[model samples]
Target: MDYSKDKLSSFLEVNYSALPMCCIQKAEVYMLDEPSSYLDVKQRLRAASLIRDMISSTTYVIVVEHDLAVLDYSSDFICCLYGVPGVYGVVTLPSGVREGFNMFLDGFIRTENMRFREDKLSFKVSEQIDEVVKRTGNFKYPSMTKTLYHSNSTMLAGFLKPDEEVEMPATTVSYKPQKISPKYESIVRHMLHEKIPNMYTYPHFKSDVMNPLMIDQLMDRKVQTLSGGELQRVALVLCLGKTASVYLVDEPSTYLVSEQRLHAAKVIKRFIMHAKKTAFVVEHDFIMATYLADRVIVFDGEPSVEATARRLL
Candidate 1:
């Protein structure tokens, strides 16, 4: 099924607020029985009840809020609460663990916890948590405390070091364009249908310098040459000509109206899916990115691109 259809199916099946409150509380696990079709209120309630039941059966329940943009301490705590085996070591303190659950709600804590796990295989929230536990007199519960170490010098030293240069392998890095095979020609033709001015004559001008009707009109004596947006579209068409395992495009919506930009994005995505080639596009427009990309990346001035890619995925 198409992306929109899949998303709508999921949305309908998991729409908790739409379902009856009682059903949501009693359900175990929800599955998309017929993902291709739309679901009514009754179907949604049944799905929610199944999911609720599954969650209730487990010792530790984790509820991930859909609107949560960042996973924080609460998310990590929930994950750890569920992930660890045996109920003996795990502790669920009284509701008054902190002054408010705000500290545990920020995603930064979750990110830091992940970093701690990667570096030390253990995560300890601040000593304040222990203080809070003592204040509330929940000390009888077996609690797990994690200690995090902070070293300014070590952090600065890593930042000061020069970034390692990536060397392109000699065999794969070539300056010349590889010839397009006849089998791949069909894919190219299909992609060109939307970008090309006249679909009828696209086959005749695949490799020729002859511009499309729009390009010709722009270059006419009465009108000025093509604008930046027009040039970018031409650049995009040229980029698609190369043969590669993956295509990395950065911000194709530089100068275009909303509708036009969306149209361009759809065309590019179709090409990628049709060719069965991986496409990595970096975009700041959230709406367009959500519609066009399979995954999104949010950069935070970090040295590693993988860090951002992981969060997006």
Candidate 2:
């Protein structure tokens, strides 16, 4: 195989790079930093298995991950890192996976008896979840079966509850896939101009979403030069700028920090409400998911193997 001639996809690039470390030239201790960054749900599951397989009596693996789902699946013992950014930092003693996550979310460390922040972050429950549900239309639903036939395989997705349907009808969609062109080189200002509803077009969105995302600050910079987080913000604005009946946004929280995630969620929610548009988002961040989802469609079963989608109310 000519490595130089063949252009590998992002998934292949990630797996191929890690293959050398785990398969060919083995190292005593393997370190993976955010291996799930650009991967989809199925890919993250496969990666978790791959990372787990690298562990043995003689070999050790250490991973730094932000996606709680991937972190939970990939880790045995969990360590929490806390501190002011770009300053002194502290690492907590390894704890059980659940405990570590709780500590992080609660902003309180039980073992250390430390409180990092005054407030606790948690998923929205009964009342809070209800407030986010918007009524876009009144539609009828009945138990119906539709099969899409292909030569190789069949796929199914349950979009509504068994008793209900037509809540969200099929329509024209604006989809933002997980993979983006990392090599696209153009000034941010020029790049954004190429998208629909340029910066000059929507003054309100400029203040509401773009400003919070720091897009104004990045206007002079080049797309290829922007950091991952910056690029994500840019991509989001571009996706939202387009007019569509249904917006399919994949992994909007990728490369964003906690604050950025929340901000992005707000932007999406506000856009949906103001434009009277529907958005179907694929996200691993529970906070973002809780904030954006009115109803959930869960994909169950094995990743990259077989799965079933069931509607969760």
* Clashing residue pair totals per candidate (backbone < 3 A): 12, 1
The CA lDDT at 192 in model 2 is 73
User: Best TM-score goes to which candidate?
Assistant: 2
Best by lDDT: 2
Q: Which digits, one per residue and each the tens of the lDDT, describe model 2 over residues 1-313?
A: 3444245534435554554455455689888877776554666787888888888999888888877777899899898887754357888999999998888889898877889977776554335555555465443333233311110011112232332333444466676656567566778887777776454358887877788687877889888987777888888988788777877787888777665677788788888878888777877676578777877766555433334455445
User: How many pairs of residues collide in model 2?
Assistant: 1
Q: Which segments of model 2 are wrong by more than 4 Å?
A: 1-25, 38-46, 49-53, 56-58, 76-103, 106-120, 125-173, 182-185, 193-203, 257-259, 284-290, 298-313
* TM-score of candidate 1 versus the correct structure, residues matched by position: 0.33
Q: Output the worst ten-in-a-row residue range by lDDT, candidate 1.
A: 141-150
lDDT of 1 by residue, 133-210 (tens): 122322111111120011111122222221233222222110111111122223323444434446324543332322
Query: Which regions of candidate 1 are displaced past 4 Å?
Result: 1-162, 165-224, 302-312
Q: What does the lDDT read for residue 232 in candidate 1?
A: 50
lDDT of 1 at 155: 20
Give per-model TM-scores: 0.33, 0.63
